[model samples]
Every structure is written in structure tokens, then in C-alpha cells.
Target: MGRQLATALLRASSLEPRHINISTRRPETLGGLFLDQRWVSAVLYSLLNMCTAQKLGAGKTLRLLNGLFETNTFTYHSLVNSPSASDLNSPDDLFPWMSLVDAQTKDTPLTDLVLRDKGLRDCFSVMYYNVFSNLAEG
Candidate 1:
């Protein structure tokens, strides 16, 4: 059930395997998808960034799952847009984010990260970045 969902999401996002992050509380349950353990930390950071970028409202959450229970990808974003409040008040929360691609790490080769990693490379075609507009009613 998990693998099937992950595969479906990979196809949908067109992220290519390298850009996806598969993680779980139980690594054994994820099976072979795990690449570097440090990826989990990266994922958390990405999620936190996205969440902090947007304006808080109903909030938005997206999840990408795969078949064979091999990979599981998740993302979420939430923010508060208020001119009266300063950006300093924003709360940074990542919960446990992970990504198929670690764009920030300098040492790791992207090709190796993509071609070598099983689930991360084989999942999607491209990674997406979302932008939010911060505008106050005139």
C-alpha cells in the first residue's frame, strides 16, 4: 500500500527520484528506500521553510506516498501575513521533514544522489518550490 502510493506520487509530481524524500518513524517499515540518515534532517528544514513562507489561513498540506511501502514523501506550508505583526514573530516548525534531493549539501554530487539512491532517484522528475504573495488589503 505504501509503495504503490509513493510510486503514484512520483509520477504525479514529476520530481524524479533524486528530488523526493522518503522517511518514516520506523526505518524498517520503509525497507530499502533509505539513502543517507542525514536526509531526514534536510527534509525537516525544507518543510519548515515552506511553512514559514506562506500566510497562515486554513493552511495547506500535501503528501506523496509510494508502492512496495518503499518510499513516503510529505510536505506542508503555513504562514501568517499581517502587516501589523513583524516577521520575527513567525514560528518555525518542521515536525520531521525530508526531501528526495538535498540541494543545500555542498559535498554530495547531485548525480550520485540521484542515480545512486534507489527510491530518491527513481521517484520523480523535478522538484518544485512554491511562492506566496504577501499583500495587505489597501
Candidate 2:
């Protein structure tokens, strides 16, 4: 199921193989990995804050973040898989905001930030709500 979704996303978007993380096992105990309700609220708040700071509307901010996610995911994957072989650089030229977050977060990768901290995995409903709300407002 996950692989199917990943394949669809890859074909629909500019995502590459490295932009995806697939886990075959479904661990019953996610521990701190589970997306809490508080994290959902935090994701919304952070999105709004980021949109305001960047002077971009919610829709544009979402688009920009999407691009950043793709770029960062590939870069991070290269670094982890073959640090010596990969000559991947930061997306500072294209996504300064993403680069800043990547630098400030230290050990946390941008892909993890978008997928885990932003609750993208389990908070799809919340994200859909936000997208619809933004579309309605715009």
C-alpha cells in the first residue's frame, strides 16, 4: 500500500526514489513517533507562522514547502547512503527557508521535520482541512 502511494506520488510530482522512506514493518509501538493531537495543532500554528513570516499566502507556502521537502529529502538520502560518494549541497540557493531550518535543527533532517514533526503521516485529515480552507478563502 505504501509503495503504491509512493509510486503514485513519484509519478505525479518531481519526487525521486530518495525522496521517499518506506518501512515494511508496522510496529505496534510507535512510542514518540506517533502523531499526537498537540502536534496537529502545532503543525497548523507553525504553517500559519511560516506563511506570515515568508510573506507568502498559505497556498504558496505549502507549495514552497513541498518543493523544499523534495530537495531536502534527496539531499539527506544521499548524505546518509553515500556521504563520500554524494556531492549533494544544501538547497540554500533555491530554498533559503528550508536551508535555515535544516541548519538550525542540527541533527533533525528536513524530511523528518515535514514527515514526523509536521504530522504528515497521520494528520492527513488535518492537512486536507487546511488545504480546503485555504482554497475556500482564496
Candidate 3:
């Protein structure tokens, strides 16, 4: 269930690697949760460790993301404007989002689900910046 939501959010947001953060009760517990590609980040959340709060800050998780992305920090325009910029409004922009949404709706669990390395589940799960794959690059 955790991984499903994580992957769904990833696909919905265009596979931005930086946006996803996985933290387990211990660093060693971060296993499973790899759905996108090599460029994606797989963090390990931990109960003893509260690093997420540091980055997200005080009780503003959803609000922070809303404002962050709303400012166009990583919007389609932002990507297209970057040095490696491409068209965010193109067909490519919508494909991954649609595909990801479909996978989630169809109940396709993330590939290679495992819990090796002691990464505890239920500690934490997050969706952060996306790193576009070659498929997204026309």
C-alpha cells in the first residue's frame, strides 16, 4: 500500500527523482519502492530519525509542496526553460502522467517489491522532485 501510493505519486508528478524521499527506521531498511528507473532516488525512512521534518518543516508538508510547485519551481515551463529545457506542454508531458495513473488504477504493484536491509515499512513515504526519463525526452 505504501509503495503503491509512492509510485502513483511519482508517475502523477512526472517521475521527478528529487521529489521522492524514502526514509525507514534505519538507513539499512530502504528496500523495495523502485518503480521508475536508475535516476530515481530511494530514501530510507526511520522512526528514530526525523529528518523529514527538517526538510519539510513544522506541520506544513502538503502546504509546502503546494506552494513550492505552485511557484513554478518545477512546472512544465520551468523544465522547458532550463538549459536542458524541453516542452512541458507537449504530448510527452502528459504521457507518463497518464500511464502512471493507469497503472495505479489498474492495481499494478511496483516491480520487485522486497524488504531487505531492514528498512521498516510505515516509517515514512514521500514524493518529491521528478527526474524525467528518456521516454519523456522527445
Candidate 4:
């Protein structure tokens, strides 16, 4: 699932695989713990909600998922006029406070720390910075 989504995002040009942090158990590997671990039910439920037919207004969440999997871009502003406040994922999910593709920003120091690791730094796409800035004011 992670590979497919990452490929889709890369294919869409929304984010390159080198620009998306997937974490690692072994050096030089792109995806490791992200796919290997169990996600907290809450975060999984939320993501599942986004995948399901309803929950988000006008089915935008599902659309976002689809866009992430098969479109040229996620089209954040066009699909969702107002992105809801992001919920924090459990520590088990990694980067719990980092928003998805929504054009909202929040602090996730732990996430930042992980992303800044020697191997993972520079892995997240520019679009990620555009939406989720690491700057204190962003």
C-alpha cells in the first residue's frame, strides 16, 4: 500500500520518492518501519475514514486519497475550501501531528527530528514544505 501510494505520488509529480520520508530499519532503504509497523486504530480509523465513502464533506477525503493514488496533484485548495484541524496520530504511526496533503501546517518536532535524520533529510518533497512548513511561524 505504501509503495503504491508513493509510486502514485511520484507519478503524479506531487512528490518524488526521494522527497517523501518513509523511514528505515536498514540503511539506504527508502521504506521500512512505515509499512512494517502497526498503526494505532485511531489513526488507521481516520485514514480509513478518508478512504471510505463519507465522513469528510462532499467525499473530499476520499477524493484526496484517490488523488494521492492516481492524479496529477492532490488539489488541496480546490477540493477542500477549508481543511479541518488535523488530529495527531499516535506515536506508533510516526509524525502524528503532520498533516496529510491539506494546506495546513502544524508543529511536529518529533516528526521533524525523524525527518531530519542523516539518511532521511532532503527526502520530503517541496510540496510538503509548501503545505507543512517547518519554520516556527509556518
Q: Which candidate number would show the highest lDDT if scored against the true structure?
A: 2
Model 1, which residues run further than 4 Å from truth?
Answer: 1-31, 56-138
lDDT of 4: 0.32
Cα lDDT of model 4 by residue, 6-113, tens digit: 333344345444455433233335342231111211222234334432334323553554454343322222222233223212212221222343212332332333
lDDT of each: 0.33, 0.38, 0.28, 0.32
| RMSD, candidate 3, Å | 16.6
Q: Write the per-residue lDDT of candidate 1 for residues 1-138, one digit (tens) a residue.
A: 433333434443446665544332343354533334234333433433444344322222223112222344322221112332243332242222223355345322333334445555434311211000001110
Clashes of 1: 36
For candidate 2, which ten residues in a row score worst on lDDT? 91-100
Best by TM-score: 2
Decoy 3 TM-score against native: 0.19
Name model 2 segments beyond 4 Å from true.
1-32, 68-119, 122-138
Q: For model 3, how many clashes?
A: 20
Q: Residue-wise lDDT of candidate 3 within 1-138, one digit each (tens)?
A: 333334444543455656544342442365534434211212211110122324432124323322423421223221112332243233332211113233333322211121221121222222221222211221
Candidate no. 2 TM-score:
0.26
Comparison by TM-score, 1 against 4, better one: 1
Candidate with the larger lDDT of 3 and 4 = 4
